[model samples]
Target: MRLKYYIIAIMALALTACSDFLEPDSISTFDTNYVFSNVDDARKGVNAIYVQFGVDGFRSRLSNNMTGNTDIERQSGWTSSGDRYQIWDLNALSSNGDLRQFWNAAYTAIRDANIAIEGIEASAALNSSDVLISKTMYHLLGEAYTLRAYWYSMLTYHFGDVPNVRLAPKAGNDFFLGKEDRNVILSQVIEDMMSIEEKMLWAEELPYGIEQVNREFTLGLIARIALQRGGYYLTPALNMERTSDYQTYYQIAKEYTEKLINLKDRPLPEDFRQVFLNNAKFVTPVNDDILFEVPFAIGNGDVGWNIGVTVQGGATASHNYGSGNNYMAIPPSYYYSFDTLDTRRDVTCAYYIVNTDFQEEFVNGGISNISQGKWSRYYLDAGPGASSAKGTGINWPMLRYADVLLMHAEAENELNGPTAAALESMARVRRRAFDSALWDEKVDNYLASISTSKEDFFDAIVNERAWEFGGEMIRKYELIRWGIYSEKMAETVQTLKDMADSAFEGTGPYADLPDYIYWKRNESGRFTVLNPNRKIAAAPDDTWTRESWLLGLRNEVTIYQEWITKDWRNYIDQGPKPGVARYIFPIPEEAVTNSQGVLANDGYGF
Candidate 1:
């Protein structure tokens, strides 16, 4: 029951391709009456909504490449002028191709979901006397609602107040529409998901399990979007603001997350690395750590191609694990921020890559180029081919159970000031991060120290999320909702500067940190490093190879690399509004032109 195979089989028959942002090509020729007459075709109609995820818009760009310059994940886009680099630099123009692709894909998916919802609601199969037929139709209806809501959630945040298209395309329907208020769009989707989530089936009950949108994912998404609605966002005037009744949304977030915890809770996986390794190995089990993932079929995803540890391979290479490069690198400051005893540190950051000779070697770039160590094509059980690069068939995780626990903790702390319920939820997530022998100090004592005040607990949650989900590309949205997007980026710039200064002058905050690291392969033929956390005078023996660590932050004539100094310059101080990141980008020029007189590029100096 692999969902991707079904989706691929039905895409051409059920989905309509869009000619522009909102105009679907030959949609009027689609026969919805026959498609939604039964459970089988209705399921195919719903599966079409997921086709957008496999395209260039999401497969390579939106998932990982476009979500950089955050506090944890980074890429110095100052030296490049490509479409993705422009986005990473936080100055994307109206003609940016990446934005155009994602914008069109989102609207196209929304249109497909709209068709499914309309057709499924009108079908008589929903009220059929056969219980299995009736129940299955209801689940398909819920999937339509949840999938449409997911696209809207991403749209409103990326491009504020996008056109809200809720109806299926028709010959006489009004295609030209104005931008709807984002708050209104979010509220509508939140209500839409809430009304249908309970009627949906759980993952285990569904044929595709976690590959399809189930009740657990819907419930978790309600909480996730409620937090986004209650949290801060940039306005057209370029000021961060939240609704006056923000606590109501927080309450919604709290209740929905608690409902999932009480009804369908599963223990977090004891091993942190296995959560992502499961994705690489194509081992998807329902009701486990991951709630839902985009099920990309063979030769259709960009997981290892653009977002994992670099693997150098080609026709001349010995191994067949094809070349892959991480567009988003882990920041050195983020690597240093982790506790030495924490098990997640080594799994989240890697300084070595698979060389062309099929051997592990240090990355050529300095400290700034450390690859995200979560998933790589090298981790695949079998390589695609020697010259393969683009598609690894790996699924992209959308939500996890750890996020639900943290969301519950955050909401309860905000409303009730770190009560016992809040403390317990936080502790549950922390316990799995450490061994039982060390839980007394790492979990128990750590919770006690952060529970003194509400604000303290919130800060702890922020830091805990950074450590727990470092390599994942969701930090940009989290920082934006917390109203610290620019603040954190500025802090990262200063931290890098301080590390560079300390390495050169030999007396500062990071002076005790290592200026050089020594490494050698162990008996198991694995790369091993010494003095990764502290300074050392010399290697233990000549068997070790030494490389400059923090000292690489500076070069011959400059205090730091030019790209490092200019990494987040506009996002910090030179954006549309100084000291504020203009998170909203303009709608693509083609979209605006196609809107007739209904849309305009008007706010944040667009």
Candidate 2:
């Protein structure tokens, strides 16, 4: 049952030396009969697949880059050069270092999964003498297939059509097969998952619970995959295509999401913040709504330490796990975009208070001071500055009930316009983000204001998703599928430009703050707000100078001034045009060259 401990050594049994790097070699000499001979070893084989979740490029790097550079989150100005910057700048090349890491990690996982599936299936055949395969054996095989499907899902999502390896590759095997179409890979993956849905254990039944993949996670993934395939994707041919029958995929997504939603005791959590705070506090999810998560341990991999306070700057050793590198941040415009009433805004953003550490004072160092707090170390069990660098023991949820509700609303609206069922689902998630006492009336009023048209309702879903899953890494993929990644980023650029020019005077959140003034904490220990009218104040000392003190400790200015002066504009279009190639990443250069003409780096040749 303690499978995590065994993940470290599981890969040793399957690897072998080979000439072609792309041609994965699983040692034919290793005895599959022994590895999957019993339930315990079979479980370990599955454990190996989960181990890859904690690997560098697989979870940390991918999640960081995918979620880090949208309109909501921006790359820090400090780390200006690197693969992370390439991803944020939307100009990722085939040679980007982390892109190569992501490529190698995903295919390696796929190769391991193929080996596990072959080993488990062969072991099951050898046990045919038994009247039926043991329940443990069935679950083991079910998990193996699900894991394989999950890895393939990642491959298709990022790299478009990739080599589909369903079987273990031995010494003389041709692992250098040409890439398969994405739809082709997704079909195989969907079929493989559907076949095992009934045999796997549900989240409610698992002894280890959310630490491992459960039936709900499998079902959620089915919906996610179907919805993705059902939606538009950029292909290597440099054209967008609905690779699958979209209506069928949408229906599949709808059915699975609704089924997951109506499960006997599962429902949306009463509060939105608890979804993450629970993970930060317990490091293990006990919430009913969390269907599946990637588990972490004290020493296994650097999953938690690499996110949150470690990267979000402004973290002092006093308030977080050591000092932050200021590597990732949210733009001031993004921070201002939120409605002041939404509880999620505060939890997601950390507004900069004035700093007077040196002879001169500053306001959030201008725009560079804003950062995210969703994964802050302040929420971890060890609290800020947990003595070790290994990683905080926090399990990251891959799927949540709120997402199902949102997806359900989206698909239902697409299928039959705006129905009461779809509207209600959207309301439920929105209501949770506000004050509970006022939510009922406020949410109803807000819903009534939205046009009943399908397009209007769909736009509501788009905005809600950005607010709901801001730092969770779901937004980038959503924008790409909606076919507006380029337009949205362009719009955000203009919006920031306007805000910067006006010194944020009339902006909803930043309106009342002065263009420049002093700030200091009051008796209640909260920072006092400066008057917007101070520019022409009767008091002569109320001037917009760095030396002026107006009832506070340090001079302050609206964040917009900083946005215009900083290098914020460069985040949007640092490379080529926003075309089909921009939506999908280029296959790593090493991967293509090493494949010896078997692999084509078509759309990503740049």
Candidate 3:
């Protein structure tokens, strides 16, 4: 019940990565007096949206929460028993100035979008420009709407529900703007995407980047939104009682996912690793597979912090800091998903790390092993001292062909519980983990080599996601969607902690061995123990409770945010009896005060 509702979407926002956006004017001060009269100015407005996305991304730039990354690392005092995995801290609700800046920037861009729309309309009315200019006006107007909707969607995902302020004034506090219903917000987003869908073109054929919102990306967003809304409305993951709206969402998800599956924009890369780079702006110009993603310029672009050192580093790794070290690592049992012959294992990660410097030598989750290859060294070259690092790659996929296929499998599995088609989708991802040659021999050529049942198809999907996406944080969404991540994560973490504890004391501290470690008092070495760095297993700790520890922090907004003050007990059933709340999230407390009249969702924390 103490779990905060704010959860950063790790798998969210797939456009250009680590970019920046700002204009001469600020969102806090808006002006309709100055309107858009030319295509150039209108183009600037659309570009402004991408910049806003960059700023928004900066808020989550550090990590698995707001900065969603797949490489798991331990935070401060993570191994200890006292609230080691502090979930609230990882959530998007941070007091950090960067977060505030990004939030302000998002609104600033939103304000600009509003200004653009108003300005273009007024300009057209006054007959400001010629025929070409008039056509430009309409195009820019539609573009503004698309950008506005996209920004709102991003905000909604991170904060859950927010005030629907469509207009930004030239002056004064727009916080006075009343909150819009979540349903209204979603409806607006859908309308905007659909409107732009007709106006936008495929990036491949498009001449301009700003006006070039890919139709497929918009559709993907539509699909994602439907799923989220559906899950929120119906799934027991949040323990919601409502099921009335489930079927609608299920249908929407099914329809959109199917649409993406058939897209000819691009096919899956022959090399799975190539898929990412190929989509990057620097690599292939634009792979058809990527629907849309935040674009990061090279050199000056925001190369994310050295995630390997930050996420995989241990107690002594200099790159990792007090709060953002790696406690999370790959569970060996999970490794079975990757066939030993799979070349991706080595390419995705370096099984070993050589941190001679004691400071950064062992901070990588204390496991001493790392999955280093998942991210290219280009990202690492960008950061030296600072905890924040954004890589130079302009290419970040927000939506892609592979994800579409997976979604189809997931929606299908969720609706039907599981199916062969879903299993095939899952297998295709896994088979690619091996080298193309090995894959051809073992999987493609041999039909029966990889076969699974309905019940285990999801598990296979999870494995494929983990192995393929690895450090990208895509797996986290899968865990949440399935509603069992907390328990599984707790089990995994406790097992590692126990093994390390036993190894540390039994031997005189881990002997700095890689792989597996065991303690032994050598005959010639007196009482000194021989400690190998092999991964060890410990009995599950009953005390490690997922109910309390599983992802305490999230980018999701708490319904509690709506209430001025609340009786804590109303949200949870936990005391000695530990009763759970019917519905946990309250509208953001700010919304309750900001709305025209006080409004609260039913059964929220009550």
Q: In lDDT terms, which candidate is top?
A: 1
TM-score of 1: 0.98
TM-scores of all models? 0.98, 0.84, 0.64
Off by over 4 Å in 2: 1-21, 76-79, 125-133, 300-304, 310-320, 352-366, 383-390, 504-575, 578-581
User: In model 3, where do residues sit more than 4 Å from their true spots?
Assistant: 1-35, 56-99, 116-154, 168-175, 178-184, 208-212, 233-243, 276-281, 298-301, 306-337, 350-372, 376-395, 415-428, 436-455, 494-606
Alpha-carbon RMSD to native, per candidate: 1.3, 5.4, 11.5
Residues 1-606 of candidate 1 have per-residue lDDT tens digits of: 457742356744546565575567655555898889999888888888888898899889888888788889988777788898888888888999999998988998888889899998999998899999998998999999998999898888889898989998878888999999998999999999999888799999998899889999999999999999999999998999999989999999999999999999999989999999988999888889899998988888999999888999999999999989999988888999887888888899999988888888778795978988898998999999999999899888999999999999999999999999999998988888888899999999999999999999999989988988887898988998899999998998899889988988999999989899998888877888988899999998998999999999998877697756787887799888877887787899999988887888898777
Candidates' lDDT values, in order? 0.88, 0.64, 0.44
Q: How far off is residue 142 in model 3, in Å?
A: 6.3
Off by over 4 Å in 1: 5-7, 11-14, 28-30
For model 3, state the Cα shift of residue 232 in Å: 3.7
- By TM-score, rank the candidates, best first: 1, 2, 3
lDDT, candidate 2, residue 459? 86
**Residue-wise C-alpha lDDT for candidate 3, range 1-606, written one tens digit per residue:** 110101223112211222112112343322333335456655554455556544533423422333221223222222222321222223222333444444455566676676667766676432544765655556566656766776665555444455676764444544444445555687776666656554444455444432245556666677666655555421223343323565576667667776655554355666766655443324434445555555554432332333333333334445532112222334332333355676555445433332323122222332333433444322333323333234333344456656666666766776775566655655565566665567656555443333444456566555555665555544544443344444444444444443344434444332222233223223542122122223334214432111101111111465111111111222223211123222212333333433446444433222
